[model samples]
Target: MNLRPLRPTDLARLVELNDAAYPAVPITPPEEMTALLGQADFTFGVVDETDSLLGFLIGLRPGADYASENYRYFDSRGADFLYVDRIVIDATVRGAGLGRMLYDAVFALARDEARAEIDCEVNLDPPNPQSLAFHDRLGFRRVGEQETKNGTVTVALLAALL
Candidate 1:
C-alpha cells in the first residue's frame, strides 16, 4: 500500500469512495475538492499497490487560539490540534481494514506535523453506530454533542492527544 497527498487526478475516485461509504454525506463538488486538495494543511488519500484508492482522510491544522472555540465533546484545551474533516472507505472493502489503515496514516501525518491533538466527529445516524465504536477503539473519548446539516445529531465529539 502507498499513501500520498491527494492529487487532482484522484478527486473523482476520492469523491466516489466517500459517497459510497456515506451516501448521505454532503460532499463538496468535485471542483471544490480539487481546490481544497492544494491547500497547505489538508492531507488526503491511501491507495494500494495497483494505485487503486481504498479510502481518504482530510485533516486540518488548528491554529493557536483555535482552542477557545466550542467543539462540543472534543477536548481542545491545548495549543495544537489536527481536526479530521472526513474519512471514508469504499463499501466493497468494508471488512478489509482499509478504514483503520487510512486512520493510522492520518495519525502519522498529524504526529509528523507536530499536532498536539487529534479530533473528529461522528454523526449519530442510526446506520452509523460503528463509527462511535471505532473512534472509541482508537482511544478517542466523547467530550460532547452537536447537530449537522442533515438534521442528524452527532453522538459526541471525540479527541485524543497525539
Candidate 2:
C-alpha cells in the first residue's frame, strides 16, 4: 500500500468510504469537503498499487475554525493538540494495517508539531467496539464523553499523549 496527500479527485470516493464506515458522522457534501480539505492540517489517503484509494484520514490542528462540536471542545480547552476529525477505510481493507499507517502518520505529525496530545472521539451511542479497542491498543484513553448533534449522538472523547 501507498500513502499520499489527498487530491481533489479523491473526494467522491472518500465520501463513499466515509458513508460506509461512519454513517453516524455527519455527511459532508462535495463543496464542504473541498473546503475541509483546504482547512485540514493533514489530509491523506492510503492507496493500492494502482493508486485506488483504500482509506483516508483528515485531522485538524488546534484552533481550526471549522465547527465540529468535538473539535471546538478540544479547542476550548486551551491545549495544543492534533485532532483527528475523521478516518475511514474501505471494508475490503479493514485488517490490512491501513488504519495503523494513517495513525502513525498522525502521531508523527503530533510529535513534529510539539503538540501535547492526539485527540479523537469514538461513537458510544452507536457503539463501535472495534474502534474502541483499536484506540485502546494505540494507548488512547477516554477522557470524557459528550452528546452532540443536539443529543442525537454521543461520543467518547479519547486522547493519546504525544
Candidate 3:
C-alpha cells in the first residue's frame, strides 16, 4: 500500500471504512466527513494500486473550527498540538501496520510544523482495547478522558510527544 493525500472522490469509501470502525471512532455521514475534511490541516490514506483506501487519518491543527468534543477537549489541555480527529483502518487491513504508518506520517508532519505533541482518543465505554494498546505501543499515554454523545460514549484521550 502507498500513502497519499486523500481526495474528494475517496469520501464515499472513506465513510464506509469509518462507519465500520463504529464506536471505536464515530459513524460520520459523508456530508459531515466532507465538512471535517475541509477543516483538516493534514490528511493521508493508505491505498493499493487500484487506489482503494485501506486506511486514513484526519488531522486538525490547534484552533480549527471543528466542534468535536474530543478536539475541544485537547485544546483545553494546551496548544501547539496536532489533534487526530479520526483514523480508520479497513477491517481487512487492521493488523497490517497501516495505522502506524499513517501515525508516523503525522509525527513527521508535526515535527516539520514544530508542533508540541499529537493528540487523539480511543473508545473506553465501547472498549477498544486493541486501539488503546496500539496507541500505547506508539508511545502515547492516556492524558485524560471524557464522556460525549450525551454520555453514551466515553473516550480515553491520548498524547505523544514528537
**In model 3, which range of ten residues has the least summed lDDT?**
71-80
Candidate 2 pairs with clashing backbones? none
TM-score of candidate 1 versus the correct structure, residues matched by position: 0.80
CA-lDDT, candidates in order: 0.67, 0.88, 0.91
lDDT assessment of candidate 2: 0.88
Query: What tens-digit string does per-residue lDDT give for candidate 2 at 5-53?
Result: 9998998997788777765456877888888899998887999999999
Off by over 4 Å in 1: 64-79, 150-155
Candidate order by TM-score, decreasing, is 3, 2, 1
Higher-ranked by lDDT: 1 or 3: 3
Per-model TM-score, in order, reads 0.80, 0.96, 0.97
Per lDDT, the best of the predicted structures is 3
lDDT of 3 by residue, 27-52 (tens): 89999999989989999999999888
* 10 residues in a row with least lDDT, candidate 1: 64-73
Candidate with maximal TM-score: 3
Candidates 2 and 3 compared: the better one by TM-score is: 3
Query: Total clashing residue pairs per candidate?
Result: 2, 0, 0
> Higher-TM-score candidate among 1 and 3?
3
